[model samples]
Target: MITQTISLYNWTNGVIMIAIFGLVCLTLIGILINFMMSGKKKDKTEN
Candidate 1:
């Protein structure tokens, strides 16, 4: 029973870590996309 509990805890921890990593990646991607889009707009307005 103890082993099972420990295993469950480890599994949940791994899942949480993966989820956090995914969120960070998604946020970075979003910021990069936003920057690129704004840059294009600036160029268009200048030209």
Candidate 2:
């Protein structure tokens, strides 16, 4: 029973870690896109 519990804990933790990593990656991508768009706007105004 203890071994089964341990296995379950590990599986859940792994799933949680994967979800968090995915969320962080998405956030980083969003920030990068926003930065690129702002740069484009700045260039247009300068010209």
Candidate 3:
């Protein structure tokens, strides 16, 4: 029973870590996309 509990805890921890990592990655991608779009707009207006 103790072993099972420990395994469950480990699984939950891993899932939480993965979720956090995914969120960070998504945020970075969003930032990069926004930056690129704004840059293109600026370039178009300047040209």
Best by the TM-score measure: 3
Using Cα atoms with residue i matched to residue i, what is each candidate's TM-score against the true structure? 0.69, 0.69, 0.69
Candidate 2 per-residue lDDT, tens place, 1-47, comes to 99988887787789999999999999999999999988865455766
Residue ranges of candidate 1 with Cα displaced over 4 Å: 1-9, 43-47
Q: What does candidate 3's lDDT look like per residue over 1-47, in tens digits?
A: 89978887687789999999999999999999999988865455766
Comparison by TM-score, 2 against 3, better one: 3
User: Which lDDT value does model 1 have at 7?
Assistant: 81
Model 2, position 33: C-alpha lDDT score: 96
Residue pairs in collision within model 2: none
> What local lDDT does model 2 show for residue 41?
55
Worst 10 residues of 2 by lDDT: 38-47
Error of 1 at 5 (Å): 14
Tens digits of per-residue lDDT, candidate 1, 1-47, equal 89978887687789999999999999999999999988875455766
TM-score of candidate 2 versus the correct structure, residues matched by position: 0.69
lDDT value for model 1: 0.88
Ranking by lDDT: 2, 1, 3
